[model samples]
Target: MLDVLAGHAARVRAADPLAGGQDRLPKPGLGEQLVEVPGAVGLASMDRSGLDTLNATWGPLVVHRLHARVGGPDPEAALGALLDAWTAAPRREPGPLAVLWPSRDTAAVRALAVRGFAPTVTVAARPRRPPAGQATDPRVRPATADDLDGIARLYEALVAYDAQFGWVTPRPSTPARIREHLTGTLPRSWAWVAEHDGTVTGVVIVDPPPRSRWIASMVTRMPAAYLGVMYADPAVRGRGVGAALAAAAHARLDAWGVATTLLHHAVANPLSGPFWARQGYRPVHTQWVRQGRPSAR
Candidate 1:
């Protein structure tokens, strides 16, 4: 099984240089279980047992990674067999299951969809180098303690906007949570804001990837910076505020010597897909989701 996964990873990376190699499988911790099929594998955590407990949070997730050998005779049959094995495996608990695969692996994707998996999120990446002729607006600067309120407001606006588009569900205390998150992250992460006429119009937060047991060993060969959150005031949209903020953030990451920066955007987000594309980010991994019971038949 490990050899099969390793071979699949190699082929995926070869098909798309951005799809980085997959070296580490999800190791089961306490109360967790790891399951493997012919061309697919999954790690299931028992923290979530019901639909209500299944949200977008990372903990208590059932994550599956699948790959199919392209150009092989009866590739669909091979994938269907793997999917059957995976779905038939016993689960310690019931919760939302997420399956992720390379966007270029259309065979596996089609099989998953036939089994009821739907596209949820797309993780994209681009070189940290800023494009040529990039100009930083003098008004853009590193965030300060005094800028928390403005940043929080922008974040609140972002959450609300995302909610409107059904991309996220905003909680009642989302504003306060945003404020607290910004307060805690300011000192440790690189955050910047764009100002115009003495008001912040855009914000971008970048951070180095933290050590994690879940990340694949092969994927970590190249260090990456993460674009945690980037939000611009709707009123300031189309005025170059977002571009300026992104350029500044990229310049800083490049100077830090990171090889690449990664971020995920909802494929359904009309605003985000094109905006990030304009920033040179392309999809590497596509996260497909099944909201309810497993549909493996």
Candidate 2:
């Protein structure tokens, strides 16, 4: 199993150098199953009740998670067999059953697409670069406690805007949950905001390497930072507000000597794909999801 996964990692890293060779495969815990196919192995893990225990903003929670060691010639068959074995049983929840695969590994798409999964989100990454000149707009500035409400409103708008894409759902508790999260992380987190005529119209937040350790293993780079939240008012769209906010964040990240910066965006978001691409971020991993019908068959 370890050898299979290592081979899979090598193939993936060859396609995308930013992909971390998952050298450390921890022992499967309770509710995790190891399933096999012709030339691959898959570990189907359950996160039963996991989402309910986490911050509400950390959602679009998937209960059934499938990880596969599939680098064989028939990548689609390997993955399709694994999915069949994993979803053989009826699920207890209506949440999605998901598989996160390397972005450049297009061979596995047939398996996922045939199984009803859709590429919903991307875990994008970009390596450190020299300072981007200066923020395009001078109105961008660091965030403070007094700016929390404005930030929260912008975040809610972001969620609402994204929910239309069918991946990120807007929950009633999302507003309060985001505010509560920001209240705690804002003091220590690196954040900035854009003001338009004295009203906060945009916000960006990041967790430095120390605070972003929860997801550190996702990449091979050292001292990675997570761009946790970023949103700008609709009125400020097409202005340089978003670009300026990103510039402020990247300048600080480069100064910190961070190796990689990571964030997730909906794959179907017309605005997101182009915006982040312009910022030099490319897809490292994509999360494909089969939603709603997990409980049906």
Clashing pairs in 1: 24-217
Stretches of model 2 off by over 4 angstroms after superposition = 24-26, 48-54, 133-136, 293-297
Q: Scored by CA lDDT, what does every candidate get? A: 0.65, 0.79
Q: Which ten residues in a row have the lowest lDDT in candidate 1?
A: 49-58
147-250, model 2: which lDDT tens digit per residue? 98888888888888877787655666677677788798899999999998889999999999999888767788878999978888888898878888999999
Clashing pairs in 2: none
Best by lDDT: 2
TM-score attained by model 1: 0.80
- Displacement of the residue 210 alpha carbon in candidate 1, Å: 5.4
My TM-score estimates for the predictions, one after another, are: 0.80, 0.92
Clash statistics: count for each candidate: 1, 0
Global CA lDDT of candidate 2, please?
Answer: 0.79
